[model samples]
Target: MTTAGTPTFDDRAVVLDGTLVVADLHVGRGTGGSLELPVGSNTELVERFTSLVDRHDPERVVVAGDLLHSFQTVPRPVDDTVAGFERACREAGARLVVVPGNHDTMLDAVWDGPTEAAARIGDTVVCHGHEEPPEQGDRYVIGHDHPTIEIEGQRRPCYLVGADQYRGSEVLMVPSFNALNAGVVVNEMRAGDFQSPLVTDTDELEPIVWDEQGRETLSFPPLGEFRRML
Candidate 1:
């Protein structure tokens, strides 16, 4: 179990007790364009993540998917970045498990298949959240949506936490740990479109919407806040 006052990093790794499972460790800096992406600086994100691993002293670290932005052709900078990440993980005394994402389809050549895509740690299933969630799991975590929160019209990546209303399963949508990718807005999406119908009106899953224009029109507070408004 994590002790009180234990410092945590801003990376998208899921911390259950003292165990940490991280996904989507795209280690690189800058965006596809000149504008700084909502995800932040990739190099800084990775460095901070590595720092967190060292501080948390987790048992294991799992990369659910999208370990790289693209596998078709890896840029030199990205390659170097991934190497640095691997080195850091090794130094931190944590075992790293990687799963592939659509963008990193080449990972399939190295790893196995979707069956191996998810890593089961205790009661929780960690996946990349691109396809349908596994059918036989009670608790699951994913990150494909790259969920973001709109606050005061500024969109920022954030985790979406909630319970599965139909299956009574606990679900956590981790924010993208990468700094170059803009995340998908939860309020603008339908929960059913990605996963199961188990997601319903519940206070467990809170959609943190972003307002890049300072309109604050898309922000939805925690589930409790929405319920209270209704």
Candidate 2:
């Protein structure tokens, strides 16, 4: 259970209540499975998570959504990568939990640890953001949009945050953990551009970008405010 404090944002990880939460890993993304060109290998993902775990030393690791890719055709290599990911998580000394995403419809066939449609972490609701989150949680943390922001003419993955008018809750949108997926730039997004319906209405969402080394953080105003500047 998390105490009374806001979640801490870092490179590809949201520290919440001793849990290192990440989203949109899209394992097996290389080999023409996820991107136009190959970028990372399974070992790279393992190493990255290993570093994150070693650095944060969280009690548990929660993959908010999209742990794997290739839903229509689950390649054998992808399956192996998923298996390896689960093993890597355990080796890092953090229990792995997964939430279902649209691309993860076939995830159960690969690995099974702890799975749920949504999870309650204190006042925050952790979900995939493919659908409306439950009302019980005062705040919602989700990852389906794969948010990013442009800074100094360069685009980087970012966390989108703000109060949700429709849901009447605080909303935090996590960036895709996979380095290859650059994610949807919040400024360029249009209505229905995101899988989560809440994103379309939340024009006031603030953009928080973390440096590659996770040593610095920068924040931008809401999209509405940003658009007016342009």
Candidate 3:
């Protein structure tokens, strides 16, 4: 979480046990392909990471997944985004480790960092959550749903946490790093409505809301109970 140094919330990037974890950079789908006139998402993304690197000074940065957006072809701008990302990490003095997401069928076409099926820092297992995560870990950190919540007509990115239904490990789902990708509003969604296994597999989702200052604002009740009150 970084405020003045980075955009509010760092868009849900979390630092735990020294290694910094961020997810769903989605670098070149026009930088927010769905937005009307997206520009410099590439620059903003790099700058956000740069600020994180400067603030945390972590030795390692794990891209939880989806560094690229286009699946069918390597969009020309995506290559530049990757290069700029590499440059940002290099300048910040942290090593970048990419864990492939479903969209990154050709992630290697651009990024050449330490790629892995998953990266473990202590008991925390970092995965993209497209498929099943690794079998042996006490906790899982993932992205992909791009969790969001709305209050007073304004949407804010959020983090979801709950105990795994089957595996028993704690799971933390980060919001998308892409600002324009306003994800599923957690308060209005059913647990099973989500695409991630860790999400759909359990109804224990608890929403952690952060303000524009990257400060924790509210921790909503678990979805199972919250749904009834809603």
Candidate 4:
């Protein structure tokens, strides 16, 4: 079960049972570009991630892709952040797994050899959500379209929970934990983009309509005005 209320500004952590999955962790702070925003410093990301590791004491930590802003060139600060993350994992005794996202893939790079992509542990398969869904077992977890919710005119990046069909397996699309990337609106996306059914209050996948921009438009009434409308 998810805790109610928006997460506190300083609280950049999400706990699912005893396992912790941190999304969009840009290790290097100052490395800004057209694809990346330097809103939160690299030091801040490390501090927050480390703090969560210490407090939650998760057995495994998953970096849901986009560990670095640009994988084409590993800047000095980016390298430092990677080292820092490794050190933290060692100290915390937690295993760290990295997935490749769109930003991490180098431009014009040929796929001649094996790429460091998906990771499978236990019953779940984790990967960055750019490519097609994996053909793993029943349950799948991925992060590609950082998802968000526009509730009562307020928009915040959130994890999208749903089921999809891929080789007779189920899929769950996790929202981007990255602060910079804009998420795909869940209620307004085209039905074809997603392989699984759109999850609603009824706990079933249904057809979702999309606007011109391909955002999923939700039909729920405004949050505060609901009581007044009644």
Best by lDDT: 2
Writing each residue's lDDT as its tens digit, candidate 3 over 179-204 gives 86768887767756778877654358
lDDT values of the candidates? 0.60, 0.76, 0.75, 0.51
Alpha carbon RMSD to native, model 3: 4.9
Ranking of predictions according to lDDT: 2, 3, 1, 4
Q: Per model, how many backbone clashes are there?
A: 14, 0, 0, 8
Worst 10 residues of 3 by lDDT: 1-10
lDDT of 4 by residue, 77-149 (tens): 5555566666777799887666666665542231122234665545555566566645354445565555555
Candidate 1 Cα misplacement greater than 4 A, ranges: 1-10, 27-42, 108-115, 192-204, 207-230
Q: Cα lDDT for residue 193, model 4?
A: 51
Error of 4 at 34 (Å): 5.8
Write down the TM-score for model 3: 0.86
Candidate 1 per-residue C-alpha lDDT over 1-230 given as tens digits, one digit per residue, 9 for 90 to 100 = 21222213245555665557666665432455332223435467667668768867776767777776654655556654566666777798776677665667555443332335677765666677776655446677777767665555767777676766436776667777765667665544555544434455445577643332563423356655654554
- Return the clash pairs for model 4, or none: 29-42, 164-196, 187-216, 187-217, 188-215, 188-216, 188-217, 189-216
lDDT of 4: 0.51
Residue 38 Cα positional deviation in candidate 3, in Å, after optimal superposition: 2.9
Best by TM-score: 2
